[model samples]
Target chain A: MIKITEKPIDVQKVIDTASSLNAGAVNVFIGTVRSKAHGKNVVWLEYESYESMTVAEIRKIIDEASHRWPLLGWAVSHRIGTLKPGEVSVVVAVSSPHRKESFEACQYIIDEVKTKAQIWKKKYLKTGRNGFQQAHK
Target chain B: MKLKIKTFGITRDILGGRLVEIEISQPTVSLLRSELTRRYPDLENLNSLFVAVNNKYADESEELSSTDEIALIPPVSGG
Candidate 1:
């Protein structure tokens, strides 16, 4: 499953979808909003995306990763709109017959999603200003 | 040709809105960028800016049409 949504992501759903009898290992990566950015206190975070393009790009990344790994299943989901600190922002789950392949594929998916996906984040600072900066820069 | 461009993040603030319509004589990605930077000079301050046409990242050399969907993609910050 691949989706961009306004609601909080269900991490368990992602893991369940990627779980299968053929898989011995299931790797999950969860991204959360940091309480501080650049040493400044963060009040909250707002996420936005070109929805159609974001979903399309994620699908492409999954396809590429699947080609390079012997995967059983995988799921990627992102949350948009307002999110407070400690909230989950994104989740990536991958299952494979071997532990190494699942771990590698899960890492690759999140890294690619960070760079290639069209999602953007805005940081609401406790200083009463909103800072919009690219993530993973 | 007339083009509708979608903006996000700081680009929306720089453009002063989520969408902007611009009229151009030449229909190419590079020409559009030049026109945009000419009007909104602050856009040049960004570390990187990308143009997407019809939901795909487009090259500056690619030709554009009036009906195409164009979006200004600033450096992405997603995970």
Candidate 2:
């Protein structure tokens, strides 16, 4: 289940998908609007994807991550559009026969998505009259 | 051939939520960017933006086909 959308991600739905794979253990990672980064409050985040390209790349990323590790199954979903503080921005669910693989692979999935994938990020810093800035590509 | 590129985030705001199509005999990322930046002066700071073709992250060297979907992804907020 590789999904990127503007709606708030349904964590349970994705977890249910991973659990249906019949793996013994499932590890999940949910990234929320953090309170502070660089000493600034994160007001909100506006996620932007390159539309179709982003979806294709996200599926590719999941495939690549799954191939690189020993796992029964995994799913990654990202939320686009305007996301306020405390909303889920990203979610990764991994299921495996053992705890070790599920834990390791889940972490790796997030790390790879951050660097290897073509997705970019804009941080909405909280300051008087301040809006947003491109964190990186 | 002409390729339409969708803009998102800041790019969309700059472009006023409209699609940009540029005519190109041979559409490469570099050429497309140069041509697009020229036509859309509002997107001047978007030179560094990533271009997506047909919803797959595309490299600058990729050739553009008429049916391919293109977009300008300004930045993401995924953690």
Candidate 3:
């Protein structure tokens, strides 16, 4: 399952989608809004994406990860629009027969999405100004 | 050829809207980039930008048609 939504991501649904009887391991990565950025308090974050392209791009990333690892199932979900600090923004779930593949593939998928997906986020600082800088890892 | 390019993120901010129209003598991604930078000088300040044609990352040499979907993709910052 790969999706771009404006609503808050349901992390359990993502994990459950990747769960299967044949898999022994399910690794999950949850990305949340940070309270502070560049030493300033963040009031919120507004995420934007080229919606259709973002979905297709993430699907390709998942397909590539499957080729690189032995995986049973996987799901990637990203939330757009405004999100307050501590709100969940993204979730990646991968299931495999072993722990090693699940762990490594999950990491690779998130990293690739950060660098390659057609998504961007702007930070709204407590100073009442929106930061034009791109969100950093 | 005249084309409408979709903008998002900081490009949208820099371009002052979601879409901008431009006319280029040659319809190629490279030429489009030159036209865009010439019109919106602030776009040059982005760390990097990729031009997407029909929802895929397009090569600089790729040709463009008026009907193709074009967008300015700045460096991604999503997880």
Which one is best on lDDT? 1
Lowest lDDT sum, 10 consecutive residues, model 2 chain A, at A128-137
Q: lDDT of all predictions, in order shown?
A: 0.91, 0.73, 0.89
Between candidates 2 and 3, name the one with more favorable lDDT: 3
Off by over 4 Å in 2: A20-22, A116-123, A129-137, B13-18, B23-27, B37-49, B57-67, B73-77
Error of 3 at A13 (Å): 0.7
Interface root mean square deviation of every model, in Å?
2.2, 3.7, 2.2
Writing each residue's lDDT as its tens digit, candidate 2 over B11-76 gives 766666658667898889888977877877766765457777776568889998888778876644
Give the residue spans of candidate 3 off by over 4 A: A128-137
**DockQ of every predicted complex:** 0.71, 0.35, 0.70
Q: Tens digits of per-residue lDDT for model 1 on A22-110? A: 99999999999989987777777889999999989999999999999999999999999999999999999999999999999999999
Query: For model 1, what is the C-alpha lDDT against the true structure?
Result: 0.91
Give the per-residue lDDT of model 3 (tens digit) for A52-94: 9988888889999999999999999999999999999999999
Query: Which DockQ-derived CAPRI band holds candidate 1?
Result: medium
As a whole number from 0 to 100, the lDDT of residue A89 in candidate 1 is 97
TM-score of every model versus the real structure: 0.94, 0.74, 0.93
